[model samples]
Target: MSPELIKRLTEHQPSLIGLEQCRQAAVLIPLLETPDGVQIVLEQRSPKLKHQPRDICLPGGAIEAGETPRQAAVREACEELLLRPEQIQVFGLMDVLHTNTLMLYPYAAKLTDYDMTYSTAEVERVFCVPLSFFQTQKPEQYRITLPVHPPEDFPLSRIVGGKQYQWRERREDIVFYQYQDWTIWGITAKILQAFARITR
Candidate 1:
């Protein structure tokens, strides 16, 4: 409308509109060089935890205030895996994933000098899966429909077809990978699938 407002708007950088309302988290897809081959480091959460207990996942957690996603990834790895910062070499950042309730940042890194140690309080145990397995194997995918339910107080009368108005439905695909006795699914499997595609 005004030249001043136009100039200010042009100078601003756009970001995700509602990201501030989402919980931010970061994860490190640690690559360990073993005699067999390059392996992926994964962890199983302690069953005693309140959320997602005993679920297999990457070494990461919520991003704290004033901490960058990269920093959060490294810190979570150090805390959960019982390693120092120097032991982990962060190579690159993967694509950012946006879910209904979370903004997830994944980083690809190499782990060195790790002796399979982990914090028992947060992690039940750690295991390695050959990266080649993901490179060669495909994950099983299933899609779920997401329908929006508008509030009853809304003015449906203003819309065409009134209460019968057809609202668009959204669908999301969930991936699953069965590796030995471990079952990797949900966000973790999705991330791994992306990583496999990128690396391949």
Candidate 2:
């Protein structure tokens, strides 16, 4: 490889980091073009599964060892949505959301045609919420408190005071957009809300 090519490759490495060990993940925000204009595709996760079961989500999962976030997102879409690589065109990167244990990378893409067979084991149903709805209606937001609970072994000698030291936790908001019967919230809702704001 050329010297300049190697330099650019290293400079473009993913920025995800480990905080109590962050598990990298990626998802595709697919835009379906229809006669009605554009709609954002989403999946109702399989109720049979554990870990946030039955949540509304964009198509994605954990990033595999040999793939970049973009490749992972596209591969996940293919697995969950049964989309061939050629059927969709990736636009560009969206914002990356980092939680306590997960680093999620979401990519914006244009999806063609409604002919799709979703993996029933992974998805309960695939549906589209018209992009216009999100553009017009803002999501309901609620702030929840985060309380810090440190272990008894927490070093006190290093601090100016011992256990008397004051600690604070930041408040985080849980966003919701109720589309008919579906309650889209959490990370999925955050991604949708961000997309709506940017496209508006």
Candidate 3:
């Protein structure tokens, strides 16, 4: 990013900042490479989870008391996807973000293996999509619906050669690409958007 752009982004930091009433959640943005291009790890929540059941997400969870964000992210990734901390290379931290329901801190990581499995307890499925999809997209296509005021009917669109889709938020729906049977969405997509902008 240009210094000016970084400055502007930092000025907009309040929008990215999490709340002081935080629950200390952490997410790992796992990147991998294949002949197709660089890919990102994603997960589909179990249909049984009370919040956002069956929704697409990253391997993450609330940080236990005394646990650092890295510790929490590493532990959650291991427990959910059988991925060990030693197997992941930490990239860096992104700005904090919060929805009305939860405060989130996202960290980036690089994964070594393309082959992996998931535990059915919290994750229904695990998958990946090329990061190039975001390289060519814009954030305006994303929407923001307040938790207190959700849209009556959400709009859907096919993008990225039907490999990707989005559900309407405010003016835009969160961007998602289907990796195998898993659908990526929500804040996971937002974090991807931020990373794409920074890296591209």
Winner by TM-score: 1
Runs in model 2 lying further than 4 Å from the true structure:
1-20
In model 3, state the lDDT of residue 136: 76
Which order, best to worst by lDDT? Answer: 1, 2, 3
| Greater-lDDT candidate between 2 and 3 | 2
Per-residue lDDT of model 2, residues 14-52, tens digit only: 754564498889999999888898988999999988978
Query: What would the per-residue lDDT of candidate 3 be over residues 70-120, giving only the tens digit for each residue?
Result: 888888888888886778888878877766557788888888764768889
C-alpha TM-score for every candidate:
0.92, 0.87, 0.69
Candidate 2 colliding pairs: none
Write candidate 1's Cα lDDT for 62-175 as tens digits.
999999999999999999999999999999899888987899999999998999999999999999999999989999999999998999899999989989999989889999
For model 3, the local distance difference test gives 0.75
| Candidate 3 backbone collisions, by pair | 142-172, 143-172, 144-170
Return the lDDT, model 1, position 86: 99
Deviation in Å, model 2, residue 116 alpha carbon: 4.1
What TM-score does candidate 1 reach? Answer: 0.92
Looking at model 2, residue 17 earns an lDDT score of 54
Runs with alpha carbons beyond 4 Å of true place in candidate 1:
151-162
In angstroms, the error of model 3 at 55 is 0.6
